[model samples]
Target: MSAPADATASRVPAGPMARFFRRLGEGRDNSLGLLAILIVLVVVLSFVSPYFLTATNLLNIGRGIAIVGIVAVGETIVIIAGGFDLSVGSVMAASGMIAGFLVTHGAPLPAAFAAALAVGALVGFINGAIISYARINPLIATLATLAIIRGLGYVISGGRELVISDEAFLTFGVGQVFGVPYIVILLVATFAVFAWLMPRTLFGRYAYAIGSSAKAAQRAGVPVSRWRIVYYVTCGLLSALAGLVFVARTGNAQPSAALGIELDVITAVILGGTSLTGGRGRLWGTFIGLLLLGVVNNGLILVGVPAFWQQVVKGTILLVAVLYDELRRNRVEEA
Candidate 1:
């Protein structure tokens, strides 16, 4: 009887908790786990701050993170392709200044937008070309361009803010539909498009392949150089688009706009589980990361934390996320 009972127990499937832990050990719970963390954070913050769950504040959070979320989408793409763009913040300033300069000079709204996008695309192309063809390190390449682009922005804006009064142009920034902010809508749409693009398109597969192993991708006829350029250029264009939204939201294009935004974008991307080493991430993860940051920022302010301390918290979070990512990478390699 004892022998028969032992055989029957051995044949039983694993329980729910066992399966859950097994999946987690296999590293399959990344995004889902992050989402769970985000939910807990939201619930806790809501309880700690009465204003947190208010509709007004909720909408405000959406508006606040709109630009960061938008630029982060591009950063996600670039990082996934095993590159970085430290110049996105600078590019945002330059692009916005270009559009504001044009609008103030009587350029039509469409023309102004076109010029700004062109500037962004041109800068992106340069960054891509240097990295892909000249074989420059992405960090050094984008950092150099960061300074150059920022200087250009200062020169173009004459070291001052370019304020625009064009209602038509401003509408893009301030407009809303069905009581929802246009900027928020734009952010959601951008994420939706890329979310589709990444999993459903060959371009996404090529990006993953390149990030996994550029040499292997090259051998597989993945056009590593071309795709790299495409990723950087797309990053540039998206950063520029975010700049336009920034200008709209703020009603001015200051040369200093989006300063340090790259840090926030990169931090969000990494926190969202997009590997800093590349090739393993999801767009939705980035979105959740953005929301997490936004919630923390808002919660801190609502709970009366000083502004400077918020920076400290953000920096600490970024460091921890990076360290965890490195450890996870090591574990994956060892496995």
Candidate 2:
């Protein structure tokens, strides 16, 4: 009787509580996989080029990725809400031009910066309103805005580059904090804020819930329209910030600056495992994704890969990431 009881106890499956904790550990392991990739890339690149492992080269790569990483955080938010934005690059150009023109006209940096950010928010508001209120698809709306904004950028600059002469503004671009680039610090701060918002806040959970299933979210009273608007607004504000950073780094704002940055931002977000179909993503994942791309680009230069070929490689990587995202989504649905 004692043997039978012992055997029966052993045969029983582990409790749901144990299984739950095990699954949580597995999820953590999945998260670590991203870090592992970053480590491997760093190791491989260091082997490929002696210059690649230098402190300056590493800092340069971080600075190089800052703009895209910042922009991609906003993109990650928008994408998690089940929408796509094609106007971010154009918005960056236009907003920076607004600031540049202001400085050209003798406006103070603070006032000009405020105006530029306000314009970006307004553009984002229009996008959100049109998508939610007018019921237009995000892709179509933003695509149209992309051209309109790009044209506006050209008109504002009069097809010329506005050279910023403000020493203070330029310093924001090249400055360092505790021996680390200011731009990298800014990127880190932005990532931390968004990470907290997306995973630890009520609004953030609602955003993800709505994207996961609009009908279900509606039934749950998630206020889908309101959150969507907030998402786009945040996107716009950050895009303007990114534009300013770009201008600081380049010391000029041209109509052509950030011409294809939206694609890169989107690509990084997708490669980070954010579902384009909506509702799933982590800010940290997007952070790593941007860094990965930055590392790749830097590695290419160190290895003497030509600029022309870099574009091709970038496109190929984007294609693969998108395809992988779609397949991953399909697998989740099937399961």
**Highest-TM-score candidate:** 1
What are the runs in model 2 whose C-alpha is more than 4 Å off? Answer: 1-31
Instruction: Give RMSD (Å) of candidate 1 vs. truth.
Output: 2.4
Each prediction's total of clashing residue pairs, residues at least 3 apart in sequence or on different chains, is: 0, 0
Q: Each prediction's Cα RMSD?
A: 2.4, 4.3
| Cα distance off (Å), candidate 1, residue 58 | 0.9
TM-score of each: 0.95, 0.90
Point to the candidate with the largest lDDT. Answer: 1
lDDT of 1 by residue, 25-126 (tens): 776556666677779988999889888999889999999999999999999999998999999999899999999989999999999999999988999999
Note the residue pairs that clash in candidate 2: none
lDDT of 1 at 107: 90
Worst 10 residues of 1 by lDDT: 24-33
